[model samples]
Target: MPTSQIAPFRLLRWFAGLSAIVIVLIAWANAWVVSSFLADHLFQREAAVSRDFVQNVLVSDGSINYLTHPDDPELQRSFYKSIEHLSKMHDVLRTNVYGRDKLMLWSTTQSLVGQRFDDNDELVDALQNELVVHAGRITPEIRPKDEYAGLSPRANYFMEIYIPVTLPGTGEVVGVVELYKAPLALTQAVQEGDREVAVAAVVGALALFLSLFWLVRRADRTMREQHTQLLEAETMAAIGELASSVAHNIRNPLASIRSAAELSLESPEDHGAESARDIIGDVDRISARITELLRLSRTGASAIQPTDMVALLQDCVADHQNTFRRRQQELVLDSQVTQAVCTVDAHLLQQVLHSVLANASEAMPDGKRCQIRVSEASRKTVRIEVSDSGAGITPEVLKDVFRPFFTTKPQGLGLGLPLAKRIVEGFGGQMTIDSQPGVGTTVRIDLPKA
Candidate 1:
């Protein structure tokens, strides 16, 4: 069944969209939080300033004289003169001074003076030795068109504070001082701070988003690479099955040909004997090739076992003796470890070593030497090095050496290096090659120690 796939980069696009939404939400939350914090802060600060201002301005000239002589013309004149000017300050919208009995002693509004209001919650709280503060604002959208007609936004913003006035030089309960002010400085400060908090929130969120975006993008790239490798692996597996079947079918006829050649070689007619020997060699080579194909076809199912790598390396060298002699190549084994053990499928490991040896031998068509070395790579790993003293591969060819079906030899199936690499990786090992054009080539494999 065919399945549809989303276009590439869809994940990134989705992430960008989601991040933008998240940042916007963060901005709103920051604005609301900052606004509430600033409001509470301003209330506390303004309450303190109002209580102190009223206390000082009221008693700086005289003390209890006004509280007892509210109707006395002389003291009234003094009290009126002392506080009347404060109400006219730019931010002060109105001011009311209440006596201890809750009678309004003085106010910015002349008519409100001497009036008693018992039901005002803020005023009642103030009379109880507590300060009360309330803030209200009318935006243009909610303004009463006729009542708040000519009011500026600054005028629309107001703070009402009811403070308990304490007697000078003592904590005596005196009266309540109420101030309703526009609080221009506080209003503007809050607006500016809210903006800054929102900006900071967005900047921080974007930084986090970008960091996450980069990591996800890298993961997506890795996933794509793995997907490509999976497709190649599936294709190779299909081809391997077909090649195995062909190799199996050819083995019977190939064996019959080898038996006939062997019988003819015993005829002892010189030329016929020589030809039979050559035919027999060709048949044996073909049989070996078929065996390699069959081995590769059985690849993914290799059984794993704890193996002594030193012994395995020695066996690999011994097994390649016939190929070494036939190809006019010398094989040498060097080990720094007597027994480096690892967990791997023994047959697969042998197949890989054989492939490496054969490639190394074939590199020096005119005859050369190949070396295999086993040593401890680290406390937890064993390293195997296969070096060939043949004219090395070119940089262009070297890069593609492990690609499936890529080879320099006419008869090469091109699966050797790639298969070797796959098998090594399945054994929890890594394989790499280093080649210098005129010097030589070396293949390194590192596996975890058992």
Candidate 2:
């Protein structure tokens, strides 16, 4: 495919890829933030629940007294029964009571009771009256069974909470309550929230990607159209230069051939004098066509000079008056500007006007009326209109009338209007044509005043 066709798709792909990357980054960041928030929220809720359980249910004046003096079998049995009942109510996998010395005073796992945990950070923090919460792999000694036998395999995923138990009516730290929670519901909620956030992020990213893709595709399409137009303009410019060079090369030979034919026609006694005359006529026509092409190719380098508009128009009309008269057509000149002076290349302007006149004459081959009107179109500009009462150009044909080498007539070279348009534009003027089939055609030229 051409670069023009491929460039847009490449740009679209680049935009899509970049958007996808951005979406992934945004989604990851969103998920991280949401997960962190949910985790903190769930931990805080569990900590609050554990703190209440320790203060209201596990640590009371009687419980603290019984813990201080565990020699009373009835009080110890009551404490154990209370801990066991509370453990069932809450979804607690394991429970441990730690004294001020960081030694396990009692545990639902009776085997761990009386164990000294001097280096335990959770016990140390709890003794300082600070609650500690953590979730991690289960240690072999701390693993729960029996009531939590089904949770043993996932014991590694348990959340352990340590809460301080202060003495009643005093701020003194007495003991600590350690609760290990399964965290199945909390984990499930957090995972569900993460999934929802991921889904939303993906959907939002897809929407944004599609919108950006559409916009990029639209811009790419516009660029491709402009590129194609630029290519066409460049091609036309190259063709104009080529035509100019070819016309220059052919004009000399055409002149030589016409001259030789004219010399042969001068021989009245020559048997083929008529053929010689025909040859001369054909050569002259070819020479005229080549001259038009040469005019189309030339870029006027001369500075614009002030010229009398009325006199210029009159002179151009007079030059073509003989041809119109010979063909029995009427040529009318109408000027509305009082001081008709404009800045233009006189030679180029004359060529444009003469070409317009020839086209008008040809349009009205039946010797109908052709008119030229000059008027002040604006304060700084003048307008000239050449109109003819003849078979007008069709809409389809009119669109390409200014295109070089596009002619309706069989013998027409078709460079006339295009060359005229070029000359007018070179002087910063504009040229336009308006026509309707079977009605008439009008050519308008607007130029700046001197």
Candidate 3:
């Protein structure tokens, strides 16, 4: 395998990179849209104020009637006199009034007074009753050198607004009121709006990225858990198939052997009776091993519910009483808690108890003591302890006790302890075994309290 394949790209880094790209793009787009909107909004407000100034203050006293005969020096003088003082007070660099013929009718700068500006789109649109405001910066290349000369040294930005003057009753366009003013206030307002939009975009982008990261991380964990379960399911399926094959091939022969041995024992002849008895016991042990394999293959967890472990332990002890007596083993039950309730499948819990108890009884062939103790381990859990007074396991054998199909006894299939432990853990419980060589073995099971 290549070195690149040894350490592949992880999901977290991939998602984080993708999230950063997407969030950055979104933030940029939002800033652009909000900035454009704020600039347009401010422009519209300024245009409204300019229109109001032209209609109400400049043309209010019927001086607007002078534009029809715009070439008249007397009318031009009267129009300039009326608006000149007000325009200069408002920081107007230069103003030009254009008639419907696209002729510069009136001007604050004497050089442009008679000039016809037919190429001026702002004046043409305003002549058709449109309110046009063109905003830009003043440069050395600006046209009509007369107006550019009057501009202030500090005022780089300018607002050129065009307002149409109509008759009193009928809404008609006679001439355009064009004003060239410095935009110090508008510049300040736009700068403030840009700062606010930039801050908002950054905060919003961070929030979105964090949310996406959290959701992706949660999904990654869920995927890993599902993958582990799929592997476990495939393993169990393979084991089930093997167990089925072994049982199909070996069970019938073992049964026939056992039956033949029993028949020979029934006969009066004692010649081969002892050997027949031995053969019968061996066949029965093989059959027991086969049955254990079948059970192990079919093992799975059932839903857990509240169960009174005191009654469960008593019932398990009672069920094995006759068997224990035949083996000459002493069974004792001791409990600190009377009604120790735990969350587990009742049938599966009984099976676990049976396996451990049977193992304990089988450990001592010469009638030794075996005890079961129940107690509340904590507010959240209940504990069951099973100890046997038999030849305890050595350290080497003890470590492998819960390993599947690992055993020391001659006929042991070695699935009992492993199966028991699996059943206990299936319902969110724990099982542990402690043993000292030549002393005894004690198994403890802890289950969550209901």
Number of the top-ranking candidate, with lDDT as the measure: 1
Q: List the residue pairs that clash in candidate 2.
A: none
Q: Write the per-residue lDDT of candidate 1 for residues 267-343, one digit (tens) a residue.
A: 85767888888889998888877776676677779888899999999999999978888877888899998899999
Over 85-147, each residue of candidate 3 has an lDDT whose tens digit, in order, gives 656755577677777777776677778877899888778888888888777766767734665
Q: What are the per-residue Cα lDDT tens digits for candidate 2 across 312-418?
A: 99999889999999999999898886567888988889988988888888888766999999998999989999999989998889988877678888988777777
> Whole-model lDDT, candidate 2?
0.79
Candidate 2, which segments miss by more than 4 Å at Cα?
Answer: 1-9, 18-22, 59-75, 136-157, 240-450
**Root-mean-square deviation (CA) per prediction:** 7.7, 9.5, 9.0
Clashes of each: 0, 0, 0
TM-score of 3: 0.60
